[model samples]
Target: MDLQISVFLLFILFTAGHSFRCYDCLGLTGSCANQTVQTCPSGFSQCQSLTVVIQVGSITYKTKAKDCAPFCQSGSINFGFMKVSYSCCNTDQCNAQDAPDPSNVPNGKTCYSCDDWSCSNTVSCSGTEDRCIKATWIAGGKSVKGCASKSICDVTAFSNFKGISCCEGNLCNCEGNLCNGAQSITQSFLFLCCSLLSYFLLH
Candidate 1:
């Protein structure tokens, strides 16, 4: 563990020198803004500044994170500290109706969880998540008909945050950790084209 900490600190020093490369390899840290993050093994443990700004009609909402992941790497790998920002914008015929009322969203109506996806504990308000969450718009009306048949969702849908599920039947759930089966594919039409290109050039 001490060795890991030392390695992390050393990376911190290197971060000062290889600033641009550090930006690209940004890891499991919550999507924060203008902060330095450090994690080990996979190697991203902290997100220094998480600046989130949301513009909603007449009101603009902004917040920042001043802490690293909730727990240290040695003892905990699931707990993460991240800044979350959500804004309600105005549509063509609608103005921003809500501004993420704290009473509503430290655990919001939209926040959800899903364990079947075998997702990593990336820090969420409501434990687990929903597969599909949709909201319908409220058109200009007093009663506005049936809430079920309303048609459009008022809020953005939070569905399938993580991708497909993968596992070894009963042994391991390494699919999510490594590259997903879909994107990690090697056999493809493009591969065939590249192979043909090399052969054609040699000929």
Candidate 2:
């Protein structure tokens, strides 16, 4: 009987160790000042915080989210004019802190952007963006050129764009027919919190 009791206690301890309590939130705009706690599901190894900044023309939108992540990593993604930055941690409720906003200062990098009748418009790079990208769609015969973060330029974020090219120099996208310019970077800081949900979908 003693042996049986010891085995049950060991199982309880193992189960407790595997389950992690973390803060969860999603699709939050502005800030993450208010949040709730929940147990992370199996297969999730870390708590995560993701912040995305999407800019279209002059209007910029931000989204903040926290949940369980498969791994702990911090990186940024920039596509066209939209940019996303994320950070992940392994401690319980470690994601409680919000991510910093994208910087607004210019980084002295430049690239071409598309306009009504031409793709020769110039765009300034911002924040961690340091690459110039030129993407052409084979089916639609459309092309878009803009500045991007190094991480986003390296990743295959757009599978639909059949022809994609990236360069590191100012206005490098315009080397042959493109123009010349520099780039810049920026960040934001706002804390708007809400209830955190489970992070099991991070796998």
lDDT of 1 by residue, 1-203 (tens): 99999999999998765421111111123332443422322232332222233233455443433332211111100111211222212111111121122221222212211121222222222221211121211211110000110111222221111122321121122234321322222334233223322321221
Give candidate 2 regions above 4 Å deviation: 1-12, 15-17, 111-122, 132-167, 171-203
TM per candidate comes to: 0.19, 0.55
Misplaced by over 4 Å in model 1 are 1-80, 83-90, 101-122, 127-203
Give all candidates' CA lDDT scores.
0.24, 0.61
Q: Where does the lowest 10-residue lDDT sum fall in candidate 1?
A: 141-150
Model 2 sits at a Cα RMSD from the real structure of 9.0
Query: 6-95, model 2: which lDDT tens digit per residue?
Result: 999999999777678678765545676667887887777788776767565687777777777655445543443545566667887788
lDDT (Cα, 0-100) at 23 in candidate 1: 17
CA shift of 128, model 2, Å: 2.9
Candidate 1's C-alpha lDDT?
A: 0.24
